[model samples]
Target: MGVVEADEADRPVSSIVLIEPANRADLPAIVSILARETLLGVRDSADPGAFPDYERAFEEIVADPRTTLYVARLEGQVVGTFQLIFFRALLRHGALLAHAEAVQVDPEVRGHGVGRAMMDFAIAEARRRGAGSLQLASNKQRLDAHRFYERAGFEKRLDGFKIDLSGH
Candidate 1:
């Protein structure tokens, strides 16, 4: 999950590259990555071709001060994405907290450090934004993902359970 320096600063960075506050133009690629991963995990996800109208969501998030999206690019192709949502909580000295959600790396880019780079960027972004704490949720069955998070200094501190509301 560590960043590997390139021979030239201007040269294309390898494995993992992070770009923050992705625009609506990036949603199609991000949706593709999510759909692919969801299919691999056997989750009832929307079809890649039917990812819906994300123009409004993207515009809203990009315009909002409390939200950000980090896109992982490999060899100039967007291969993964994650979102950070910031909120204020009274318990933490009235400081901002950031939560990372919907993290996904393309199957082709998995194990190549893309996910790690994206997370590293998110953590730095949270710090830059004056967030007092950074958190993320991972499913219990994703052992590999959990291990990766652990290696990156995350701890399994909370258990979250949920039931679907879509009534599928």
Candidate 2:
């Protein structure tokens, strides 16, 4: 909501971070951030040749009314991103569920409250959307991410599993 100030010892800087729905033009930066900042970079790429595929995927995601891809901008530069999906769940008496994925913040801005602000934005957005809960899964090997999520008030109540359909 306000400009986040980095610790003086870490980096004496402050800037307003705004999280909003991403546009087509933001895809390149978004892809670059994902590839450069996350462990999933092995599967994600920022190559110029990869733009076509990313563009197609972005089109489909934006077409869906229940889904939104968001970007966090710091001083007008793309610095972070996350995707949020809203769905109805039968388990919680037909409650609306918000699933957040692909959250990443540039390494250059780590520990500057960018991630925290992005997460806080996600939580607020979920609530504003009338979601009963906001849920996300972090890679088991991402211990730092786990700690960050915990600090954000998320609980480790269940284990998560996935099967790679790509069959790589």
Candidate 3:
């Protein structure tokens, strides 16, 4: 789904456009932002051309109805990106849950509320989709990100465990 909305802050806020299902053209910028994260950066190439497999994966994700790859733009330039996945589970009364992943904002615009707008969009979209909850998982090393999420109204509700099946 495609959408555009003005900043709704009662106080002044910078302009940011959140696009659901981010297009292929935004890949390079998205990669750049992902490369800025201390933990994720070590595993990222930052240059999309270096990874053909990512292109294939991106295509698959784009075709999947349950996922949306969001790209945040400012002044027509892509600055941030994330993936939101919708799932239904027996828990929460089988309500659909919105899970966000790989959220990243350009280092150049880190303190400009760009991440806030992206997250606001994710939360709003989850509500729009009748989701029971909106959630995201941050790396244990991302203390700053945890603080940011808390400031954005997220809580430390559960402990998450993951198996490294990728074996990287």
Candidate 4:
């Protein structure tokens, strides 16, 4: 039930308004946004309902204690989505870290500050949860996204690696 209300009075156009936790009905829209991404498109299902595994994954995400999937609504349209996962660590003074993943903004509303708003909410949420740090990983090819994350006050300090078995 976490939500962030947007101030449309300060903007030229009032497209984005409410940001809330994504529910089952939002799966199609979320998948659509993911499908539009150049890097994730190959991994996300083309037809939103074609993947039953996604439904299972959603169910698992729901059962998890430290995970949240959020979608941004722009005038009743689901235009953006991101997932936040909190991690418990024995290091760093046993601090809990909030990790954001699979963030996507619809192409039709890319420049309307929707992505910025989502990141702001994520940071706020991490603060609310008392997480020691917030972090995320974006593909090296997504230079534009890297710039965006930087603008959101994220520093590229540590290097991350991943072994892709899916060949995406």
| Most lDDT-accurate candidate | 2
Q: What is the per-residue lDDT of model 1 for residues 1-168, given as tens digits with 9 covering 90 to 100?
A: 224332233244543365556667788887777767753465523464445546556777788877777787666688778889999999867889999998898888677676767777778878888989899988787889999899767888898988979675
TM-score of 4: 0.89
TM-score of 3: 0.87
lDDT of 2 by residue, 1-168 (tens): 324444354444556678889999999999998878646547878889988999999999999999999988888998999999999989879999999999999888877777887788889889998999999989888899899899888999989889989988
- lDDT scores in order: 0.74, 0.85, 0.80, 0.83
Ranking by lDDT: 2, 4, 3, 1
Which pairs of residues have clashing backbones in candidate 3? none
Error of 2 at 106 (Å): 1.0
Question: lDDT score, residue 140, model 1?
Answer: 80
Total colliding residue pairs, candidate 4: 0
TM-score of each: 0.82, 0.90, 0.87, 0.89
lDDT of 4: 0.83
Q: How far is candidate 1 from the true structure (C-alpha RMSD, Å)?
A: 4.3
For model 4, how does the per-residue alpha-carbon lDDT over 43-156 read when each residue is reduced to its tens digit? 666583676877888888888989988899877789898999999899898999999998889988876777888988999999999999999999888898999899889999
Q: What is the lDDT of residue 99 in candidate 1?
A: 98
Q: List where candidate 2 sits over 4 angstroms from the true fold.
A: 1-13, 38-41
Window of ten residues with lowest summed lDDT in model 2: 1-10
Tens-digit lDDT string for candidate 3 (48-106): 46668677778998999999888988788987788999999999688899999988888
